[model samples]
Target: MMKPVTAQDLQTAGFVPERRRGPAVSVAQATVDAIQTMIRTGHLRPGESLPPQRNLARDLSVSRATLREALSILATIGEITAKPSGRGFVCADPGEKPATPSWRFAARYSLREVYQFRHVVESYAAQLAAIGHTDPELAELRECLQTFRRAALAGDISLYAQADFDFHHLIMRICRNKLLVDMHQTFASILLESQRLPTERRGNLMHAVQEHESILEAIAIRDPEGASYYMRKHISMAGSRAGLPLSELP
Candidate 1:
């Protein structure tokens, strides 16, 4: 008879470990890795429902919030499907592709329109930020970039989404144009959703992270043209990743 998998088995596989001070992996990410490992190893079979959240969290030695976040990432990437009536999550078949999340504002705006608007506004914002940013603003931008990179590396989609928004919003603020900042803030949720959409598709996020680095380097060096150019490139590439063909982008 095969040995049954336990939390201890996950721990032995290095998916879960004892809590420590500032460990390399976030607790939530560690939990995500643990569950994915279970699915990959056939311990968590396709269509099998996961244990209740409270029980699973207890077994994993992670808080409910951390477990929820991990589960959210898994669902976003289509590793698991959430059942109705509070039934809990079920593992997906191996190699199944994640469904693209529906755009909530599709009735009001198409993705191509959003990307075109972003390309125009954000690229100009990047140029202005490069010219007008103070040292402290630049420092904050660098911090946001680091946060984005870390979140991408960890595969924490929620964190990555926030970091991506923060980086772009910070650049908008640094541009020091009241009208531009007001416009960005007015459509903030829509823009943040746009940032989140690309992450739902299973792929290496490092490419986007590298694009962010290019924008940051240009801003750090106060090269307005370079900043604008990179920002345009990044937004265009992001649009492509979100299923907007390059030809459709402005």
Candidate 2:
């Protein structure tokens, strides 16, 4: 019978050592190494949800942003999976073989291209959301905006990014366009990368809060043109803040 892995097990696996901090990105990479050590040593298993971010960050003596970045890297490589509802990430079976790569690589675009595409689809979706969303959908949008604002003000980079993603995702969902939503889903990683950039700059985060408020208000008033306008402006501002070149607005 296997013993259930505890925090002591993680410590034994070298995940609890205090390390000298370097650059932010490097710290994230080190965190990933610590987590990989935990998995290799059976301190974490497939399908096991890791500890809450707060606990893990405290234990590792790293900021939550660094921890989240490490997890994002793991998720990208399929060593873990993010829960669809923002619950948390779960560990993947390390022994499971990865699938063969598809030819979709031939059609892959840069992050900038993906951002351009998002600006087009999401702006149009915002317009549709304004014209078609019900009262409940509008309420959900407001809730997402408030969640984002709170996260931003609290300096919770990971939660703020999640809320920002949820707000745009809600817009696409209520847009009533399956094709648009599918497109957004396909470029989800690029969108996440873009959104993460703004969190590094407080000005960008606060600006996003006001921009989302305006966008939601436009939708609330059932003004499709206003919705489209604000959405476009919001995306443009976000791109600029992230140091991405502004693309032609839709």
Candidate 3:
């Protein structure tokens, strides 16, 4: 038997078995949420221009890749019509309105639920990502980590957040599955709202940074099972710390 690796296995490997996903918000979540808020509030009409990707990413506290993934997802879910090299994503016709109870339920829902959902979906995506990830994909993942480490050391919250979001965004790209990525993008806002600050709850940022390094090493080895295990542990640990239930994440 491949030795049954417990969370403790992470330690001897020089990594804590923290939840891999950490119910963190993806870049798509942040982007979609802003767009949805604008649409319902009449701030963004059917044909309004979205700010440029770089500017929007800065404003939304996400990365360009995350925003792009969100756009792709929104387009897939019929939220916005895309324009090539256009300034922003456009609003589509509002879909069928749900019942009042449904709306209320959604409105009251926390973004943590969204992150939880991603934990499930992206956990699976991580498995796929490990299988399909290429050299370029690995490089991108490394670059994101480097940016994240640099930002963390410098105590730059915005850049840290951006880089943090990008690391997972690149992992999703490794899945060779657009549908899963799009689904995540479609509800970007909920995720943004849910995973506001995983790192905030951490007692030590440098400790967390060290854990992230282990995750990247597993992915570089293309160890799908290992990557999936680490990701699940990371997400689950964060949820536990946040006092969240996986089933209750919505």
Candidate 3 per-residue C-alpha lDDT over 1-250 given as tens digits, one digit per residue, 9 for 90 to 100: 1123233332333321122324564435545555565556565566665666776555555567876766654554445765656446656656532211112225656546555676777677778777777898888888888888898798876676567566666777778788877866676655543333544432233434565676677777878787877776556544433334333433
Q: Which digits, one per residue and each the tens of the lDDT, describe model 1 over residues 85-185?
A: 64678887765775656788799898888999999999999999999999999899889989998998899999999999999999999998989899999
Model 2 off-target regions past 4 Å? Answer: 1-108, 202-204, 246-250
lDDT, model 2:
0.74
lDDT of each: 0.81, 0.74, 0.58
Candidate that would win on TM-score? 1
lDDT, model 1, position 190: 93
Model 3, residue 227: C-alpha shift (Å):
0.6
TM-score of each: 0.61, 0.55, 0.51
lDDT at position 122, candidate 3: 69
Clash pairs for candidate 2? none
Two-way lDDT contest, 1 vs 2, winner? 1
Q: Compared to the true structure, candidate 1 yields what TM-score?
A: 0.61
Ranking by TM-score: 1, 2, 3
The Cα RMSD of model 3 versus the native structure comes to 20.0
